[model samples]
Target chain A: MVGGGQLARMTHEAGIPLGIRFKLLSDTPQDSAAQVVNDVVVGDYRDLDTLREFARGCDVITFDHEHVPTEHLRALEADGIPVRPGPDALVHAHDKGVMRARLDAIGVPCPRHRIVSDPADAVAFAAEAGGFPVILKTVRGGYDGKGVWVVRSEDEAAEPFRAGVPVLAEEKVDFVRELAANVVRSPSGQAVSYPVVESQQVNGVCDTVIAPAPNLPEELAGQAQELALRIAEELGVVGHLAVELFETADGRILVNELAMRPHNSGHWTQDGAMTSQFANHVRAVLDLPLGDPRPRVKWTVMANVLGGDYPDMYQGYLHCMARDPQLKIHMYGKDVKPGRKVGHVNTYGDDLDDVRERARHAADYLRGTITE
Target chain B: MVGGGQLARMTHEAGIPLGIRFKLLSDTPQDSAAQVVNDVVVGDYRDLDTLREFARGCDVITFDHEHVPTEHLRALEADGIPVRPGPDALVHAHDKGVMRARLDAIGVPCPRHRIVSDPADAVAFAAEAGGFPVILKTVRGGYDGKGVWVVRSEDEAAEPFRAGVPVLAEEKVDFVRELAANVVRSPSGQAVSYPVVESQQVNGVCDTVIAPAPNLPEELAGQAQELALRIAEELGVVGHLAVELFETADGRILVNELAMRPHNSGHWTQDGAMTSQFANHVRAVLDLPLGDPRPRVKWTVMANVLGGDYPDMYQGYLHCMARDPQLKIHMYGKDVKPGRKVGHVNTYGDDLDDVRERARHAADYLRGTITE
Candidate 1:
């Protein structure tokens, strides 16, 4: 239990009844989960002494963030403290360049990409791979809609290199939809996969996720789940592993990225699945038996609330709640900021379109885009 | 949400999303729910000025306990604060004598009893009712096996008169099982009922609750649900209402007691039912549309953990958890105490007996009574 964000908060919430104690390493005084769990030590995750002290009495160490220093985790492992999704596997989530190389070596299908240390390399890759509208991403530490760039031309791609950050130039993928398939794996190599979800991104930030990826062929869903499970088993990752996939115009799925902890797309499991991703993550990290990963409902949709400039953004919830009381919303106890991941709402029902629309309406209402 | 006990704490857990905030009123710094919900004001619920301060900016005022003063609630009502299950209805729960009289007047099937102001009346009632064994209860306040006594002989029946506490006496009927039916009602008079559950009580404290009350005839379950709904409507309770019933040897259902808040018997709804009792309580208190009260599984069982003097109580959970990983346990984050309503474990499955056994084992392990 480190980092007191919504993910840590939700994980702590799920762990309480299991009689599993988690000592959260909170970054702020008002971390959402800390309000209920008192064993929080306020500190920075980057501080080695703080990390060491937090891990002292714990039997194992895990994380809420992928930004943990790999060398520090390796050091903790050397001191006999078990770190799940060990340092060897975490680097894939921390560094984009390392991930691309590893996935490419493993023959995982991905868009054409090239590591560009200099502006000239990006220019050359663009000319050979594709022209303009290339995707540029930081080699290390990027999340939500940050640390990624959409370069319309070669000149735009060259500007980031001047700032001394490693970047990758990816071919503009002609994808029909963004999909995410998540799998949880135990240290013993057992794994379970959830249904693939269609992820709708607004301004590079995920806004909505529909499980079973509406209209996706059953074969494709099977293929996507298999791909995610293969990656989890191959990486020997202990914890939830999310594989973001791109459904190309040709209906082929390509790897987009990976997350080792519980991902946003799987939040629907809180109300829709037999076992939630957060609960499974805890089980995986603790080396316990995995739970059934089947969806409990026919369809589930999750919509995220991108924080906007509204003081009483939640006040609008009264109307949404009054209109459709079945909608489930999870708000992180974090201050609102433009384009930040504030909270999410999930709805599960027999009608996918209706669930999706209702979820989106609540998100749009929360973001202050609706009059009623 | 003034009190930081298990009910308030569980409600806070459900209120995380949709951002419903709770201002916990605690008498001690370590009140369990207070530890997680940061917005707590330390005060007694008896103080009107303190309650006014607590209710200043709240949209709706609700409760976890029915012990708040009726006069203070009436004052708040006159001042225009929206208190769900207003003083009039809540008073019925706080005073057992009033509840009994009201139910008797309504023609609801209940045990023939008399409100005894002292032990002499109880002795007299026992003589009239033709019983050596009689049950005596406090009229104004009692809960969880407290404020009630069994007078097996004439001398014992007359002993409580010296204490000057008002008592209620009832014939000790031979009953097969205790059952509880939970119903939720909104301000608009719409009400919903959950499946009746057979409660297992040890020493007057409820230890386990088996949902659908195994082998209950279809007509009996329907009759219980209808009786509970009728009670809720007649009482005009604008939130959760729990009717405790005794299934006499002849199969007749007799009302035993009532609760105005989310009752412990309904905890199974959190995981087993389509709409959780907590979520429904929120909807009812907020005057929102009620959700569908359908059970997802055929059976669900909840077992309470009585914090006994067991060394390394949590250590026992490891073994129980290892055996049944999916059993859901909700802990109250309280210090250990004998006969205390510390927490509960719930398990739901199609196989009723298996779920019951699993729940029973987890609770027994916590109570230091589980055999290998």
Candidate 2:
């Protein structure tokens, strides 16, 4: 797996029981996955030589992030290396403009969007879309709300163009809430979709994810799964594919963004689902039959533990374990830093309210936000 | 952890979510836990220098097995190292004679037993206990059916005497079945016990374990748990302690043996319990609050996957995964050899029969005992 972040850290863990030998191409020895994964190659993913060296003895190459240069991946594929969610599908995740154009061509429900040449082009597209508040995003290298701007007028759009990267102008989605449809696909075209989850964001970083998107009509949930699975097939994605969606107030769902690998939105599956997304991703990449994606409990709430006032969360574990003995905590093995996702807590039970409160309390307590 | 075997491998996996750094003192880099744990010292654990170096920065010293020398542990404790299940408690697990004597002193129910000096002494004890058949076990270094003998006569009893280790002779248990009572304890005296489980032994090696021991009278089950918890506290065990027991036809429970670390009997907790035995072991050794020990489902069956006809079990993963998507497979990084434990599968659900069959089938399929 390329990019040894928390996603790779978790995928490496899921691979252990399957007896899969993980060869991680990490940026440094201190990267989250590198700290645990035995066979790790610390190198830059952009360098073709480094990618080739890392793929030498690997059966199949996969990624934790979509930031790997497309040309480097193509070179590996040219050399007969199997890259799951190959360069073609991964490019869409790397560039928002490409993803928007592909989704529009495929008739997938997406917000009105266009590739903007400059700040003026963004303003014109916003005017055509009947909006003053537009979302401007760099076509490449944006994540976790970075390289994204909510522009209410032409004057506010100038900042994004100054970075000099191509920008995509999108009509601000009038959504009631955000949802994620996570699915995994194998090279044989077999696919499995997890339940749609309600994702609550704090300052553009995901703070909590409630599985099954409470109160979502059954038919709509089925439609969301169908859409996500169709997208995986259409894009020829061979691993996990997360479709971030906007649940509009008009009772319709529109595509917001796409992640070709395991995304933060699917983290709840680690403890909630019969088969975690990380495990299925490993299976899909290996072209093995996937495991079940059914929820293990009636409800599961996952809350991200961002590094906050407490630099040592271990000090809070005693209280958390005593308060909620069933809560599953997953730490990323990273140094604590304010506003960074260092871990997550998952609580599952029949009572959604109770589960949600337990999860919130644990995450908050670990962050030192709640003294009690 | 003192030993780098499957128990340590699993404990390391459990500690990952808690951000616990495991420093393994493995005999080789290829040891099961050594392959995954980052801070590893590949050295002989029997050497005082090696043990001292390994214990330098560790917060508490613990073991995956009970074979660590009592003298070495005492020295470590003398130097102020926190040796959980310290020498005094660990010696009982290391020696069957010691365990029997201690249990007898505490009035714990055990079989008619005595430390015999020779074959004649064993024969005399057996004759006095009302039978020709007698069970003889080495006082130290026995595991997985080894160092144990069931002798029916004086001629058969002579073989164990040649080993030169002190032998404990006991009246062969005339039990309907074997059972295990598992419990974990913290240094603070807090303890939690899992339900008693029926353990099936094939050729004296554990083949399967059914949690809650199907149809066990509630009162008997409660007694078994209470016995195990009392044993943990009485021994001052600061980590997981598994009490192997014999459930006689007369509805009496007798102590068989003890393990001061994670045992095969509790493997089902990986997927069946609210908190796994390995996780609780880490917490207990760290003196942190313990987690719940309740079963997550009505029934759980765990079947050990012994290395059989197949050298590569990964070949059967696709079939087993597709056949039972909910089956949780845990494979130790070990080369396949007949009669060796390579992994185990867990199945849990409302129906005991279904869970049992699923677990059995998965284990058999992985071992290549069954083609389909």
Candidate 3:
């Protein structure tokens, strides 16, 4: 396992009962899961010797984060360490430039884009792709709404590009909603897709995800799932693949980005689906047969807990538990920061509205904006 | 945590993401979960000082097993540590005599029984309850299939009871099937009951559980659940309460026994119910509102991997995973022995028969009998 955040924490948790031991690699001594899992190798991911030591005695290597350099992964694989979804496939998820180029090559529809290494290139792309309010994104290592910005004027896009940052410029999409299509693929080429979810974003960070993408047409949902399935199979990824989608006003679905591991959008599956994305990720990487992706309930929703204003948002934990008895809160042991993905809550039932509202309410309570 | 075993292992696993710290009481440095959670205090449950050290700074005290003496638990409670369920309620589950007597006093119907400390008392009770074929059970410290005997003739029952064993002689139940009703109670008096499940016992040890008690009348299931709810409420238990039910040939439900924590019968809920029994137990003990007691699917079946002829069960784990993609196996970190509750596999789907067979097949495979 890599990273000691909640995702890794949950995976480690699930593996323990099955008698499958997991060793977590973390940078900080206080990494959430490391506090509980004793076999932790504490070191920065960028340190080659640290990574090498961490990979020792491991049958196969997997990750909780996609931040490791593709070259570093390649080095491990070259030394005969079995790294699932190998570096070549993982690069599409780690770097935006690589992802865009790969998706385009596969004829997957995406937002119009341009690679901008200089300020002039950004300005030129903005001029050609309809002037104001274009999006500028870093080519690598951005997550949780970070490393992306919007520019309304030519001057606004100049500094970021001129700083010698390799950026990607794309036409700002006027989509009706953001949908996430999640899938898991095994080393044996088997793949399964979860129902597309309608993701609600607040300030570029995901606030809530409603499974089955409420009110989405059957054909559109299938198309989105097919796109995710194609990516996982084509990339030969051996774990979860989360495809963020832009559901256009005209009902077309466009790919936004991809994550080659369990993604936040699939958190609802923890309580709602027959088998969770975390469990599937473990099986996929371990070369086990994939479990069913069909959900246990009719509707499921997941809401994230962003950084709260309080020092300890735990005060609401009790109230949230009391108010929404069915809500499943998964809090990541991390210092609360503005816009940080601290935790999430999952709620599922036949009533879509009830689940959605309950999930949001618990999330709001965690954020200290609402009280029971 | 009281003991560093599989239950504690999974609890620690669940607590990691929420940043909930636990102090495990271990007998050895590598007592399973202790191998993962290093923050364990090595000592026996019989030691008060060690217990105090483990209890201090803990948010809420719970257990991994019921072997901790009731007196020690009371002492912990006296010292202001919040021991869930408390001694007064836990005694019923810890001692069979106390449980039978308490159930009788509470007006819950059970088998005609009498406590015996000698051979004379057992012979008299058997004669009164219809001679011969009586069941002799030790009142305390019996689990799995141990410490129980079937006495067909008076002579067989005489010697065991003469040893001052403190036995219970009861009319053998002529039950059509055994069922388990699981309920969770909060400290604040709130409670929720899950659907009754039919338990399959092989040689006095539980081997399987079928959720919703297949084809059980709605009224009968509701009655069983109500009985469980009433018992949990009356007992003032602040956690899970698992009531084993004996469905007699005459279609009557009788209380067989009680367990004050997550039971094997409820394992199906992990992948089948609205809220997992473990999660609900956590919620109830923490005094949080109880989760819904709704089954997510139409059917769910759980089969135990008991101590059987299986010697190299680990070798079969891969095959089981590959064979049934929907089967969920939970193996405890214990050396498998004949008649031991080492692990379980749960499967759920729309078709009850298919799910049941899948669960049974996986369980048999783990037991070293992979016969088609």
Best by DockQ: 2
Write down the worst ten-residue block by lDDT for model 1 chain A.
Answer: A13-22
Give the lDDT of residue B255 in candidate 3. 90
Per-residue lDDT for A1-372 in model 2, tens only? 999899998898787777667789999999888888778899999888999999998899999888899998899999999999999999999989889888988989999888888878877998899977899999998899999999987788899988888988999999999999999999999999999999999999999999989999888888899999999999898999999999999899999999999989999998889899999999999998998999988999999999998778988998998888888999998999999999999999999999999999999999999999
- The TM-score of candidate 2 is 0.99
lDDT of each: 0.83, 0.91, 0.83
Worst 10 residues of 3 chain A by lDDT: A156-165
Q: Write the per-residue lDDT of candidate 1 for residues B251-360, one digit (tens) a residue.
A: 89999999999998899998888778888888788776777678878888999988887745666655665687567768877878887877898898888879988898
TM-score of each: 0.89, 0.99, 0.94
Compared with the true structure, what per-residue lDDT tens digits does model 3 show for residues A224-281? 9999999888888888999999999998989998988888899888777767898899
Using DockQ as the measure, name the better of candidate 1 and candidate 3: 3
What DockQ values do the models have? 0.39, 0.71, 0.56
Where does candidate 3 chain B have its weakest 10-residue lDDT segment? B13-22
What would the per-residue lDDT of candidate 1 be over residues A233-258, giving only the tens digit for each residue? 77778999999999988979999999
Q: Largest TM-score belongs to which candidate?
A: 2
For all candidates in order, state the fraction of native interface contacts they contain: 0.36, 0.65, 0.61
Top candidate when judged by lDDT against the true structure = 2
Between candidates 1 and 2, the TM-score winner: 2
